[model samples]
Target chain A: MISSIFSQLFQTLLIVVLAPLLLGWVNQCRAWLQNKRGAGVLQPYRVLHKLFHKDAVLADNASSLFRTAPYIQFACMVLVASIVPMVATDLPFAAAADVIALVGLFALARLFAALAAMDIGTAFGSMGARREMLVASLAEPALLMILFTPALIAHSTSLTTIVEALAHREFVLYPSLAFAAVAFAMVALAENARIPVDNPATHLELTMIHEAMILEYSARHLALIEWASAIKLSNYSAIGIALFLPWGIASAGDWNAVPLALAVLFVKLLLGGAGLALLETLSAKLRIFRAPEFLGTAFLLAVLGMLMLEL
Target chain B: MATFTGQLINFLAALLLLIAFAMLSQRRILSLIHLFAWQGFILALSTTVVAYSTHQPHLYYSAFLTLVLKAFLLPWILHRLIIRLNIKWDVETMINVPTTMLVGIALVIFAFNLAAPISQLADTITRSTLGIAMASVLLSFLMMITRHKAVAQVVGFLAMENGLFFAATSATYGMPMVVELGIALDVLVGTFIFGIFFFQIRETFDSLDIKNLEKLKED
Candidate 1:
C-alpha cells in the first residue's frame, strides 16, 4: 500500500518536472533535424523560471475565469499524469479513472481553456477558441474509437486492465492495433497542435491555433499554460506507450521491477520524442481547411480498426 | 496453434481493407496506382501464406500470378501510361472526400452483414477474413464510381479484382489452376485493350477525364 502511494507521488512529481524536458528534447531534435544548433534541452526550464519570476499582466477587461484558467488547466494535466499508468500500473489513481474519465478530464481542461480564451473578448482569442472546438469535436471521436479498439481486446475500458491484457498476450500481430496506432498518431499530432495540424513554433497570426489563444497571456499565466501543455504532450505519449508498446511497464505491486520499468519508459519516451520530431520535419503544415480531412481520415481509420476486431 | 495462422490471415485481411480505404480517399493518380500495387502485393503474400498452410500447391501458382500481373506488371503499365499521357492532376472525386469516406464505411458495414451468413458456412482457417475481402471489393467499387479520371477508375477496377481473388483464396482455397490462369490472361489482355482505349479516347477528347465523353452523346 505504502509503496504504491510512494510510486504514485514519484511519478506525479517526475511528470511535472520532466514534462518540460520532454518538450525541450523534442525541440532540440527538431533543431538538429533542421540543421540548426538548438537552444538546448533545458530551454523550457529557463523559460518557465523566467515566467514564474515575473509579474503576470492582465487586460483590464479580463474576468476571474481568465485568471483561474491556467491553474485549472495545470491541475487537470497533473491529475491526468497521475491517472495514466506511465512507469507503473499499480497506482491508486488508476482504479479511480478509466480511459473515459481520462478523456473527460482532458475535455474539461480544454473547455476551460477555450472559455478563458473567449473571456477576453479579443478577436484572436475568440477565433482560436472556435478553431480549438472544431478540432476537439473531430479529434475526440477518433480518440475514443482508438481507445476502444484496445478496450475491446482487453474487454475493459480501464487503462491498467488494457495494458495488462496487451502486455501479457502472446506475440501475435494485430492488424487492428496497427491501424489504431496510425489513427492515434494522427489524433495526437492534431490534439497537441503539432506541425501538419498547427505549427507550435510559428507565430504567424493567420496560421496559429494554440498560440493564438494565449497571445494575451504573459508572465506566470503563460508559463502555467505552457507547462500544462508540456504535461499534456507527455500524457498523450504515455497513453500511447501504455496502449501499444506496453511491454516494459511495471505491473501493480511489482515494487522490485520499478527501476527497470523506469529505464524502459525513459528509452521509449526518448525514441517517441525523436520520432515526433522526425514526423514534424518530414510533413508540412496543412491548410487550415484541410485539417478536417486529415482528422476525418483518422476517425475512419479508428473505426476501421474497431471493425476489423469485430470481424 | 491452429488459431495462430488464422490470426495472421485476419491481420492480412485487415490490411487489405485498410489499403482499400486508402485507395478510396487517395487524391493523386500516381499514389493511387502505388496503393493499388501495394494492395496486389499484400494479396499475393496472403495467398502464398494460405497456400503454404493449407498444402494447396496450385494456390502457389495463383500467388505467383498475382505477384507478377497485379503488383508489378499492372502498376508498371499504369505508371508508364500516366507518364506518357502527361497526366499529373489530382484525381477529382464526384463528391467530397469526407462524404465518400462516410459512404465507404456504410458500404463496409453492409458488406460485413452481407458476408456474415456466407462466412459462417465456410470451413477454411481463413473463413473469418471473408467479410474483409467482401468489404474491400465493395470499397473498390465505391472508388470506381467516385473517381472522375479514367486511370483512377481502372486502378479501382484492378483493386476490385484483387478483392475477388482474396475472396476466392479465403472461401474455397482458390479456383482450379486452369481457371486462375485463364483469368490472369484475361486481365492482362483487358489491360492492353484498356491501354489502347486510353490513347484512342485521349486522341478523340484531348483529355482523360471521362466526363468529357458525355459530349459525344450530345451531338
Candidate 2:
C-alpha cells in the first residue's frame, strides 16, 4: 500500500515535470517541418522558470475567482494525472473515479477557467469564453460517446479496468475501434487547442480562441496556466495510451516491470508528440464557422462506432 | 476462428454501411462522387470475398463488372459531366444535417428490424450483413430526398443501385450474370440521358437546382 502511494506520487511528479518537455518537442518538430530553426526543446522549461520568478500583474477588474482559477485548473490537471494509469496500472486512485467522473473533472476545470475569463468583463475574454464553451459542448458529447464504445466492450467505466481488459485481449482488428480512434484523435486535437482547430502559436488577437481567454494574466499566473495546459495535453495522451495501446503498462502484481513500463510510456509519448506536430504542420487552420461541421463529423463517426459495436 | 471468411465479409459490409453514412452527410458535389466510387469499390471487393469463399464462378464476373462499370466508368462519366457543365457547386440539402442524420439512425434501426426474418431465411455465410445492405439502401434513398442539386440526386440514385447490388451479393450471392449485365448497361444509358437532361434543365431553368421543377409543376 505504501508502495502504491509512492508510485502515485512519483507518476504525478514525473508527468508534471515532463509535460512541458513534450510541448517543447512538438514545437521544435513543428518548426523543423516548417523550415525554420526552432527554439530548443528546453525552451518551455526556461520560460516557466522565468515566469514563476516574476511578479504577477492582474487586471484591475479581476474578481477573487479570477485569482483562484489557475490554481483550481492546475490542481484538476494534476488530479487527472494521478487518476490515469500512465506508467503503471497499480494506482490506488485508479478506481477512485470512473470515466464519467474523469470527464466531469475536465468540465469542472473548463467551467472555472471560462468563468474566470468572463470575470474580467473584457470583450476578448467573454468572446473567448463563449467560443471555448461552444467547442467544449460539442467535444464533450463526442468524447463520452467514444468512451462508451470501450466501456461497452469492457463492461466497466473505470479507466484502469478498461485498459486492463483491452491490453489482455488478443490483437484483432476491431472495425468499430478504428472509427472511434479516428474520431477520438480529432476530439483530442480540438480540445487541446491544436492546429487545424486552433493554432496554439498564432497571435492574431482578433481571432484567437485559447490565447484570448488567458490574455489578462502575466508572470506566475501565466506560468501556472501554461503548465496546466501542458499537463492537460499529457493527460490526454496518457488516456489515449491507456484506451488504445495499454500493452506495456505494468499490472499490479509486477513491481519489477515498472522500469520497462516507463520506457514504453516514454517512447509512446515521443511518437504521439511528433505525430501531433506533423498533423499541426500539415493541416491549415479551418474557418471558425466550419468548426461545428468538423465536430459534427466526429460526433457522427463516434455514433457510427457505437452502432457498429452494438451491431 | 471457425469462420474467418465469414467474419471478413461482415467487416466489408460494415465498411459499406459507413460509406453510405458518409455519402448521406457529404455536401460537396465532387466529394459525393468520390464517395460513390468508394462504395462501388467496396461492393466489388465484398463480392470477390464472397465469391472466393463460396466458390461461385459467376460472382467473379459480377465483381469485375462492378469494378469496371460503377467504380471506374460511371465516376469518370460523372466527373466529365461536371467539368463540361461547369457545375462545380456545393450541394444544397432540403432538410438540415442533424435532422437528416437522426432520420438516418431511425432508418438504420428500421432496416435491421425489417431484415430480421428475411435474413433468417437466407442460407449464405454472409447473410448476417443483409441488414447493413438494407440500411445502406435506405441511407442512399435519404440522400436522394435531401439534396437539391440534380447531379447529386442522380449520384444518390446510382448509390442506391450500388446498395441494391450489395444486397443481391450478400443475400443469395450475385444475381444471374445476364441480369447483371443488363442492369449495368441500363445504368450507363441512364447516365447519358441524365447528362442530356442536365443541359436541358440548365438551358431552361439556368441552374441545376431541382426546386425549379416544382415551379413547372405548379404552372
Q: Score the docking of each candidate (DockQ).
A: 0.77, 0.45
Candidate lDDT scores, in order, read 0.92, 0.88
Per-residue C-alpha lDDT of model 2 across residues B121-187, encoded as one tens digit per residue: 8888878788898999999999999998999999999999998998898888978988999999999
Positional deviation of A76 in candidate 1, in angstroms? 0.9
Which regions in candidate 1 have their CA more than 4 angstroms from the true location? B214-219
**Tens digits of per-residue lDDT for model 1 on B1-219?**
656777878888888998998898898999998998999899999998898888889989899999999999999999999998899788899999999999999999988898889888988888889999899999999999998889999998889889999999989999999888998998888888898989998998888889898775746
Q: Say which docking band candidate 1 falls in.
A: medium
**Chain B, TM-score, each prediction?**
0.97, 0.96
Q: What is candidate 2's lDDT per residue for A220-269, written digit by digit as tens? A: 88899999999999999999899888899988757899999999999999
